[model samples]
Target chain A: MPKRACYAQDYTGLKILHTLYDSCLKAEIDFLDDHYLLNLIVDEGCIKGAIFLDSHTGEIIQINAKAVVLATGGYGGIYHGYTTNSYGSTGDGIAVVLRAGGAVSDLEFVQFHPTALKRSSILMSESARGEGGYLVNSEGERFIDELKPRDEVARAIFRQEQEGKEVFLDVRHLGEEKLMHLLPQEVALCKLHEHIDPAKALIPIKPVAHYSMGGIEVNSSLEVQGIQGCFAVGECANAKVHGANRLGGNSLLEITSLGRFAGDHAHQYTRSASNKEANSTQRDKDQKAIEAIYAQACTLNFYEKQQALGKLMYEKVGIQRENTQLLQAMEEVRAMQEMKEQMGIADKSPIHNQNLIEYLEFSSALLLAPMIISSALARNESRGAHYKIGFEKQDDKHFAKHHIIQWKREI
Target chain B: MTITILRSHNKQEEAYPLEDKERTLLKALTDIKATQDASLTFSAGCRASVCGTCAVRVNGKEQLACAYKVQDQDVIEPLQYHEVLRDLKVNKSLTKKTLQRSTAWLQTFQEASLTPKDEKFSEKQSDCILCDACYSACPVYAVNPDFLGPFALTRAYRYSSDKREADTKTLVDNVQSNGVWDCILCAECTLACPKGIDPKTDILMLRSLSIEQGYTDPTFVQQSFGFDPNAGF
Candidate 1:
């Protein structure tokens, strides 16, 4: 097989991130390091700028720009405890886009990587299988094809765990030298996190929420469809390049390629002479909204709801989805949203208040949960990552077009 | 289990008696934040140690919170020699400046093909996560605050060794002042690096490379006998 992607050892993403960050620094770009995005500032469908809360001082600030690009990443963090995303991948940008009356597309197609470290939900890179690793059950039987697509492999592993058998990634045949030479990060991670060296031991693994293929809808030029001067790229924008299922290693390609295009288009948009008025009213509204969150009665703990959301998303709306479970998940998420008024943070410090940030992030995830579940329910076919139990076959005839969800006031 | 965390907000150590369960320091800290104190602030990403945002000092040793297992009577504090944002969260903005100051990336986008053997040469150096563990552990930062710390110099070595890098002269010039020569080579950074990257050796290699470029140690040049700064005799 030909190599689909270029890699710098096992730390490809890290290397790419460092290169980009270095380039930004060398270019003398101004960086607001600890600012947390609060909301977008849009006036008459044209994006003015955004509002952010300085995590250090807890002061709300608004910046007005001619062109705004949302590269804030994906919604995989919505799954919480069962996701391989970062602590801050709470779909805040996607939710903010929706609330600002922008459309979100293909949000139901969430790709679950077949092998995440079972304990910490950390990703075990796909190269494990690419390097001839085997997926074995407790009985040491290879059940499914290890080389299958991500969604199928994830479902097979999910089925095995459902039948009360544990699945493991057996790479012992690869030998210690070969394992270390090929996948050094995997070896170090298994040894340090699980206390099981993969060279000698069977590494326990499971599928977890890894990537969100769906996000804010964008056109060929990577601009958000309805909103002018607004562009969403990377995981935050659904450019329809991946459709329902994204192939492994394609996301990096998408980000690098479309990310550049988004930047270029945004820069071009800024160059055009349009001296627009700043949306100062939205900043005040956002500030009041944040203050309101601080004033809410602390009747329901946000952490409990956040954990419950994770469990609910993983169990019900996860790999094997059905109509009843989808409906149940939808109702539960809506109920949580109804009780949102009672959920408040105990920490009121005007500093790096993680509690407040997490509370805001959870609220964003909560707002997008129904959108995902409803999209899953609307599409009654198993296509790509959306594996509906009753409709396991892809019915392209009915669900061929893009499934888009716009925030409606009547919800 | 008793856990003592250096809380930055109140400038004191706060202890929490936690249940002795199998968990990482990050999970334990998160639990404390959720149930015990909501005012606790820490940074974590990718929980897998790949992102490297969750580094904290565990009993005076730098460890990624997600990678380090929790033990009884474990003490956790923010990384050393940096501005602390809160409990266990330190400002990492210095990493960007140091990397920029070192000119650590390829100077020009010249294309060069590489075989497996070529890639393996600098493979170890490419594994840095910029977690700042090495920066936190280096004693040189305590004195010379402007020394282009371990991770940056290692990155500078990474690019300088790259086959595609056309010019290391500018990069070598950039690291002359507070760059490679400033390293005492204590290897404290090598021990603290969670990714196992050897920055001390990389700095030594940079020093040798500097000599080939007709540059000597600044310390030797500044000595009274080596160079007559007073212009006497």
Candidate 2:
């Protein structure tokens, strides 16, 4: 309890910003253009300077840099109902890297943090359990021990859900004063939004999608495999340090440490680059693709498709998945992709067009969703965040190796 | 079930049968009004606590109308000190204007070299929905409206802490001149914050940052150094 109180005190000192919407998109664009020391253009078999697209004007701004760092976050948004990650995180960097012929490793592994705010799609940080909060079932029974790892807690919650009992976080022992100080946001959310107080009432809770264990594979130097001059960091790049499961407070630590490392490495790499000239022909093709994407975005009935995708993913590929369900999800995603292509328009005007941006995001999400479902199905092992009901046990012999996915040549 | 209501305005009490399976405070109020024109007025939006628009006093404690499900008998009143325009709506323009006066949006730096990693440092502060749940809960705001409160001071600290912002000195100077540094650091703001934004800690950080910038609160420095005017004279 004292440790919990102290942790709450510490959080007060740390200031953080949570990205919700266009900010994530803008941040990616800015980091690629204004901040990066090197822009790596991955095409066919050659790596060169990256061509930048002015998202505002639809013009290609070619830049010559020594190296490129991908600080793009994770793929939690690919899951239908996730508690941890921001909604906008949908594996854009993963798709872009795959498109550029960069090798991706562990594309199937995903981490599901247990103890999301019960009944709501909000994450109750593992810090909560770290702070001495206990998990309880509908019968007011202390069902699971608090200090269990995230993977264990997630599985426990899933079991509880299957048994037809509502799982809740019992923080009533912490008392109102402590609850108010330690978890003011959660306390307020429950009291005001859910009309339940953690100090006096049991919090309705459930496990939801959390973190992506799979990403563009990179080494200690932060360089992506098979692609020269490109580096991936943060949740965007799978450093394999986290292996299958990530520890609490490790994410912030990982982002800061790896982000700086990648930035520094990119700076050094850019400084050493012999080729400083912009490839005009490649730049032109990239420009045309950007324009075509913008045009296609305008006429797309994206929201309807997005909703359908969300529902399908939630039902078929959510927390608990089987081979049959994943196959259905794959079929549905392919059909949706065809519909998305047919609905694509050719409007070239780019005036702060959010619709166009959302369409691009939706397209990226659609492409990435199948990768997750298919990867989930193929892994067929109970390891870390991925739980396969058909193949219940952790099959380390066959599934020990990471699942790698590459884009089909024809697509 | 028969529900009883306690009227605070004229100390009147009434009872009515509640037919609805789930009866909230707002629903109960509607029923009471329908049967009899009880002159109870309050503000509400989203009927959810997310908006922070419908905060009121229920049974001597501050609660949101959109939240706080009503029981059989519940006493409801408006928030204290602020002039209530009607039943429960208080003039929040004063606090809003104070934030504007602080120029909370002014960033000192045009652009700082920030990686996506750098963005994570102050990311939680940016998640502020500006519910003013902290404002209502702050004891300092209740005692001194001009104390710069939690939200405004937190906003000031947010920009000041940003490496990209260039005008940290101006911000520090503005806070030093007033009662901004006089905050007791009771952490009521932290306790009241619904988004987990600890404005109290933000204030402390701002004070430290301010001290680092050579803009120290003269009174605090003098007191700590044991400087007495009478002894000096």
Q: Pick the candidate with the highest TM-score.
A: 1
Residue pairs with backbone atoms closer than 3 Å in model 1 (clashes): none
What lDDT score goes with residue A90 in model 2? 72
TM (chain A) per model: 0.97, 0.85
Give a tens-digit lDDT track for model 2, residues A123-195: 6556556767888888777777778778778778878878998888888888888776566666765665456
Model 1 C-alpha lDDT per residue in residues B1-233, reported as the tens digit of each score: 98899987688999998997888888998899888888888898887778879999999999999888889888888898888878889899876589888988888766999889988888888888889999999999999999999999999999898889889888888899988989998999999999889999999999999999999998877774656667777
Candidate 2 regions off by >4 Å? A1-40, A43-60, A81-83, A293-300, A345-349, A407-411, B1-233
| Candidate 1 residue lDDT tens string, A37-84 | 888877777888899999878889999889999999999999988998
TM-score of candidate 1 against the unseen true structure? 0.97
Best by lDDT: 1
- Candidate 1 deviant stretches above 4 angstroms: A408-411, B222-233
| lDDT of model 1 at position A206 | 87
Recovered share of real interface contacts in candidate 2: 0.02
Q: What's the true lDDT of residue A375 in model 1?
A: 89
Model 1, retained fraction of real contacts?
A: 0.92
Q: Taking the true A–B contacts (Cα pairs closer than 8 Å), what share appears in each candidate?
A: 0.92, 0.02
